[model samples]
Target: MPEHAEAGPSRTRPRAPRRKVYPTETFIDGRGDTLAIRTFAEEDTDLAGITRLCDEELSEPYNVYTFRYFLEDWPHLTFFVFPSADDPEPIATIICKLDMHRERTMRGYIGMLSVDKAWRRRSIARKLVELAMSRMELAGANEIVLETEFDNGPSLALYEAMGFVREKRVHRFYSNGKDAFRLIRPLAQHPLLSMAALRERQDAEQRSMAKEGGDNRSAVPPEIAVLLAGPLAPPTAAHADAMAELASLTIEPLPKPRPPPSYIM
Candidate 1:
């Protein structure tokens, strides 16, 4: 049998096409300069500008690696708003990333957003956020989430106007010791509202009630304890129900008991 010819090097597989950037229409700032709003593009070198704007405006400090972590992985989700065609730096920018949250839901997280002071009140921030949300929704994100300073009225109002709700408050979330509000905008039925999440919430509430009961027992005064155990006290089942409600703090018991005297008057 003839010897087989030496095999040639294997051809490399073609890479998948890059995801398309989100589209935008023409927008002019208050100064009549046409603004460009779009995702980070291959030809763009705005990383330094983006970093500068964020550092100048945002309360949080991020190193270059943090910016790279998001931009390199999710360039399509990173958007910028330039005040004019000739301007090399963007006046506003929003950075975001999409991934599985809790291994259950597809969540989009907006990591940073900043707008130059000169560009304030021109609707630039809102427009950039809306653009990011639309792209995230199209990319199969079930919900988009972001955190802003709790007392940042302008940020809160802008997000709320766009249908985002305050999901929860994170205590001392910033390096400056300020609190933040985790806001969420659901493109579809949010995972937090699913049966599994609802069950988890219910169990948490029950545990909280149980803990409250233990606290109340320790806090009860001797005089009030006597009233709860007297002959006219509620029946056993009714008493349990009352205790449960009390533990939940749903209602206050009537006729507040006077404090027990330290000694006989």
Candidate 2:
């Protein structure tokens, strides 16, 4: 994890930095042939190259303008590229949006996940997703979700193998009237899931909070209970103080009624 900037003003605060867990390259063949998987950064002209590749290779029209859009709007979204290890240039790509709804929810919606036909069946898409999820989890997402064409057997199987279950099926969701299946995977659970260890980490957190007299009932209001329980971001001292003040106010009794409305005349 490369430290970029702290979440808070203090340098001592833990920063949610992005790290490339999987190397930018991986062996694709037993004979030492490899492929490079890289997260896209701003000012990368490779987006246009990969977009052109997808267009020419996959006949994908929807993504024709995606690369242009990505270059215009980077950072708000994440893009990953896969290049033949021998070439070390982008040949495939995937894009994901972080906090799409701004609900302070640790979730991401994957879009435009694709690999070139030349690289099909090479497990490059799967590797791209794995790499994306690692960055997403590290950035504080607890769940990652995506939608794919119902007829895309390979994509469906890949997602299922990665523990993504079909959450919904929408009819004619695509521009071409093809149905789409929405799949989701909780990053903090299930075996083989990269972030599964977070469950144990959360348990340890609960135990620590308990030791510090930080019961949920005392600290969180019913309205925001789910948010409080979520792993979005830890509260600041001011937030904690506000909650404590609210809790104290809620526990205080109403002031005694003023002498029954003064007397009637």
User: Which model scores highest in TM-score?
Assistant: 1
Q: Residue 181 CA error for candidate 2 (Å)? A: 0.5
Local distance difference test scores for all models: 0.73, 0.60
How far is each candidate from the true structure, as Cα RMSD in Å? 18.0, 20.6
TM-score on alpha carbons, each prediction: 0.61, 0.57
Model 1 scores what on Cα lDDT?
Answer: 0.73
**Which ten contiguous residues of candidate 2 have the minimum total lDDT?**
256-265
TM-score of 1: 0.61
Error of 2 at 214 (Å): 23
Error of 1 at 177 (Å): 0.9
Among residues 3 or more apart in sequence or in different chains, the pairs in candidate 2 whose N, CA or C atoms overlap within 3 Å are: none
Question: Where does candidate 1 stray beyond 4 Å?
Answer: 1-25, 29-33, 42-44, 189-265
Candidate 1 residue-wise lDDT, 180-249, digit = tens: 9999888765645554554555556557767877432323333334333554765565566656665786
